[model samples]
Target chain A: MRSGYYKETIVEHINLTDSTLQRAWIGIGLLLVIAAPFHFEFYGLSLITLMMITAIGAMGLNVLTGWTGLISLGQTAFMVLGAYAYAISTESWGWPPLLGFVLAGIVPAIASVIVGVPSLRLTGLYLAITTLASAFIVNHLVLEFDGLTNGSSGIFVNRPVIFGYAFDTDAKFYYLTAGFGILTILACLNLRRSRIGRALIAIRDNDNAARVMGIDLRAYKLYAFVASSFIVGISGALYGIFLSFVTVDGFPFLLAIEALAILIVGGMGSIAGAILGAVFLVGLPEVTSFVFSWMGSSAQSLLSTSAHEIKGLLYGLIIILFLRLQPHGLMGLWQDARRTWTLWPLKY
Target chain B: MNYLAELLASGLAVGAVYGLIAMSFAIIYKSTGLLNFAQGEMGMIIAYVAWSISTSVDGNPFIVALGSIGFAVLFALAVERIVIRPMMSEPILSQIMVTIGLSVIFRSAIILIWDGLPHNMAIASGNQLVDLGGVRVRAAQIAVLVALFAAIAGMWAFFRYSRFGVAMRAVASDDATAQLMGVSSGKVQMAAWAAAAVLSGVAGVLFAIAYELSPSLYALGLKAFPATILGGLDAVIGSAVGGLIIGVTENLVGGYISSGLKEVAGFVIIILILMVRPYGLFGEKRIERL
Candidate 1:
C-alpha cells in the first residue's frame, strides 16, 4: 500500500508538478543571489567570484564530457590560450580589453578544431591521452613563443573597463563575474534546449543510433569540443581579469583534473550541478581551513603547509566515494531528496 | 661521434626504466582492461620504502630492492581489494577516474610523510663510469639495461611455462570462458596487479639511484603512458619495444633539435601513431557489435 502511494506521488510529480517546482527553485536562486553577497565581506566575496568563474569552466567541461561523452584533459590548455590571447591583444596589440575577451573565446575554439580533428577517431581513454598530450604540447608552445606570450614571466592583464567604469575593486569584479556567471548559466540552459544539444545527447547515448537518425557524428563531436571550449576560454579570460595577470604556471595538469572533478561532483549534464559543485569544492576547503585555524596556532601553521595536500586528499576521496556510490554527484543526490520530499506522507 | 654515443647510452638507460613501467602498465591492462593511472605513484611509494629499508639495513642494495618489491606486491593486492574490487562493474570512465583519485591520494600522502624533499639513494653504483672505445657510460646504466632485458626475458619464459601465468593469459583472452574452465577472474586480476606493482617497484628503485627521490617522480607515470599506447595497452612484449622507441626518439630530438622539444616529442609521435593505427601497433582489434 505504501509502495502504491509512493508510485502515485512520483507519477503525479512528474506529470503535473515539474514546472511549478522549477519555478520555485528559480525563485530561491534569485533570492540567494540578491541576499548572499551582502553577507560576506571582501575575501569571501572574492572567493565566491572565483567559484563562479570555475563554475563556468566546469559547465564548459560538462557540455563535452557529461552531455556529449568526450573526455578531455585539455581544458586548461584552452584556458591558457584564452588567457594569453586576452593578454596579447589587450597589452601588446593595443586592442580594447573588451574586444580581447571576445578574441579569447574565438582563438581557443579555432585551436580546439585543430586538436580535435584527428584525435576524435580514437575511442575511450585513447582520446583522453591525446588531449592530455596536446595540453603538454601547447604548454611547451606557450613557452616557446616567448615573444608573443612574454615567456614564463607571464603578462599583466588590464582591469576590465566598460565605458569608463573600471572593475578594479573586488566588489566591482564580484558584480562583473556574477553578471557573466548568470549569462553563462542562461546560455547553457538555452543550449540544452537547442537542436544541437539534443543531437549531442543522441550521439552520446548511442553513436550508431545517432548516425542512423542522421546526426553527423564528426560534425557534432567537433562542435561539442569547439563550443564547450569556447565557454571555457571565456572563463579563462575572466580568470585572468580576476588575477590581473596570466602565467604559464597558473595552468597545469592539476587545474585540468580539478575542473574534471568539479564537473563530476556537480552532476555532469546540468548547469545547476556545475554551480553547486563549484560552491562545494571551492567553499569546503575555505571552511575546513577556518575550522583548523580555530584549533590553535600550531594547527594553523601545519594547515598552511599541508592545505593543498589535504585538499588533494579530500578531492580524491570525494571522487572515489561519489563514483562508487553516487555517480550522479551532488546534483543527483539533490534530485533524490526532492523525489523523496514530494512523496512525503507515504513511508515508501 | 662520441657525443652521439654518450647520448644513446644515456637515452637507452632512461628508456629501460620507462620500459619497466610500461610493462607494468601492460600487465594490469591485459587482464583487467583498466589503465592504472596511479602506476608511478605506486612506484614512488615503493621506492621510498626501499630507501627506508636500505637505510635501516646498512644500505644493503639487494635486500632493500627485494624487500621493496615484496611490499609493492602486497600494497597492490590491498589496493585492488579495497578500491578497485568495488569498481569492477562501473563504467570505464569511472574506473579511470578512481585511478586518478588514487594517484592524487598517493602523491599527497607521500608529500605529507616525506615533506617533498629530495633524497639520494647513494646506492653501491657510486657514480662509477666505464669507457667503451672512449665513450663513457655509467655502470649503473649498464645494470639498468641488463636488468630490464633479463626481466622481460623472464616474463616471457614465465608466461609460456608457469601454470598461474597461463591461467592469466586465458583470463585475458576470455574471462567467461576461463571461468568456465575453473579459473578465478578475481585471483588473476590480483596477480596481474601484483606483478605490475613489482615491476614498477624495481623501476622506481633503479630510477632513484640515477635521480634524486622526489614526489614529482610520478610524472614519469604520465610519460610512460605513451609507451603503453604506442605498443598496445594489452601487449606485454610490445611495451618494451615501444619504450625503447620513445626513449631513443626523445633523446635524438633533444640532442639534435632544441632540448625543449624532447618533452613534447613523445606526445607528438604518439598522436601521429594513433592517427594511423587506432588500436596501436600491437593492440588486439576490438570489434563492437551494435
Candidate 2:
C-alpha cells in the first residue's frame, strides 16, 4: 500500500534514469562537496562540523514539528541532556567517550518517553506551553543540580581520546563530528523511507485519518518524539565535546527558536532541507556574522560573551525575513528555480 | 502568621504588576489570536519611556507619574502602528517570529539608548504608609491595587456596553461578518492593538512605580507568559486573575521555598496545568480544520 503511495507521490517528481540533464547537476554538486574539504581545509572542515551538528538537531526537530506537526520548544533541552549526560557519564564516571556519547542520546530518548506520553494529547498552543515549560525546566535543572552539572557555574569538558589518540584540535574533532553528522543525516534519510516515517507524515497531516488507516498513532508519535530527542541529545554531546564546556545558558529557548527558523527557512519534511536549513541558517550566519562583526572586539568577547547575543539576534531576524519571502523556504525556492529554468532557451 | 500577612502584602503588590502585563497580553490575544510575544518587551520599552518622561516632565512627582504613563501609551501605540500591525495577518508562527525579532530590536535599541542602567524613580513619594494591624504597608502598594481595579473596571465598563467593544467582539467572532455588519475589522484590529498598548502603559507604570526599570525588564515577557498560560490565553479576566496567582505563588515560593527556585516553580506549575487543563483555566478551544 505504501510503496504504491510513494510511487504516486514522489516518483512523479523525479525518475532517476530520466535525469540525463540533471545528472550533470548532480555531478557538479558532488565535485563541489568532495573538493570542498581539501580547498578550504579546516575552515571547510569546521563549517561542515557545525553544519552537521545543527543538521542533526534540525532532523530531530523536523520529525517533531515538520513530520508529526507537534510544536516543541524543548529542542535545546534534549540537546543539553545529551551534553550534560555525556559530560557527567564520561568525565565524572570515567566511562569512555563513545559509550558516554551513546548514553547522551539514550538519556533524552528516555526523557521524551516520560515527557511526551502525557503532553502529546494536547493540540496546538497548549502543547506548546508544555514544551516551553520543559525548556525552562531543563535550564533550571542544569543550573540547580550543582552536584552533577556544577549548577549555573557550569562544568568544563576535556577533549575526547580515542584509542590512546587525543582529538585535541578542531581539525581532529571536525573529522569525528562530521562523520557523526553524515551518519545521522543518512539515518534520518533512510528513516524517512520507512513505514514509521509515513505514519508520522500521516499523523502530521491528519491524525484521525491516520488512525483510521491503522496507523498506531500513540506508538509512532512516541517513537518520533524519542528519536528526535535522541538526535538532539547527540548534537548536545557533540557541542560539549566541541566546546569543552557546558552551562545552563548553553541550551536556551533561542536554540529552539533558531531550529524553528531553520525548519521554516529550509522547508519542512525533507532531510536535504534540514541540512540546507542548518548550513544556510546556522552555519552561514555563524561564519559571516561573526567575521563581519569582529572589527575591533577582543577575541575573548568575540567567541565567549558578546558574540553569542549578537549572533542570536541576527539569526532571529534572518529567519523571519527568510520565512516572509520564501514561505516554502530556500529548498522550495531551489526546486522552483529548476523548473522555471528547464526550458529557458525555448518556450515549451 | 506575620509571615503570611507580609507575604500577602508583597505578593499583592507584585501580582498587580504581573496582572497589568497579562491584561495587555489577554487584550491582544482576545482581539487578534496572536500571542504578541513582544508584549513583555513592549512593557519594558514603555517602562523606559515612563522613566525618561518622568525625568523630563518636572520635579513634581505626580506630574512625573502622569508623564510616564502618557509616554508609555504613546510608545505602545507607535509600536502597534509600525511593527505589529504589519504582522497582524501572517501565520501564527510568522507573527511569533516577527514579534521575537521586534523584541530583539527593541531590547538592542534600548541598550543603545539606556546603556543597561537601572532607573530609580519615586513614583510613590508621599512617605505615606498605611498601618493594618501593626503592619505598615507602603501607600504606593495600596495605590497599585486600586489602580489595577480601576483599570479593570474601566475595561469592564468599556467592553460591557461600549460601541467599539461590541464591534471588536464582532470582529473577533468573524472578521468578514463583522465587516459586513459595518464593523471595520482593520480599525477594530488597530483599536484592539491600541487598547493593548494602553494596558501596557498601565503595566509599565505599575512596574516602574514598584520596581526598578532596566533593559532586562524585558524578561518579564517570558515570566508573564506563564500568567497567560495559567489564566487561559485569550481570557481578559484570566489575565488579571492569572497575574495574581502567578505573583502570589512566585513570591510564596521565593519566600518559603527558595528564591532560586522562583522561575522554575512557576513554569513547573504551567506544565502541570497544561497537562491537565491544556486550554488553560478559561481559554476557549477551537479545533482547526485543514
By TM-score, who's the top model here? 1
TM, chain A, every candidate? 0.91, 0.84
Tens digits of per-residue lDDT, candidate 1, B7-78, equal 887888888878889999999988888889999999999988888898899887778877887899899999
Q: Residue-wise lDDT of candidate 1 within A37-133, one digit each (tens)? A: 7798988888888998999899888889888988887899999999999989988898887788889999999999998898778666787888889
For all the predictions, what are the DockQ values?
Answer: 0.61, 0.44
Tens-digit lDDT string for candidate 2 (A1-348):
121224455655433334466778867865765555566776667777777788888988898888888878778889989999999998889999889988999999998887888786775555666777888887777777789888877778898887788888876787677668767876786777678988899998889999999998789989999989999899999987766888867776678888887888899777778888888865765565567656555653544544555665677567657756676788899987866677465544
Lowest lDDT block of 10, candidate 1 chain A: A1-10
CAPRI quality level assigned to candidate 2 from its DockQ score: acceptable
Q: List where candidate 1 sits over 4 angstroms from the true fold.
A: A1-21, A35-37, A345-348, B287-290
Give candidate 2's error at residue A312 in angstroms: 4.0
TM-score of chain B of each: 0.96, 0.91
When candidate 1 is compared with the true two-chain complex, its DockQ is 0.61
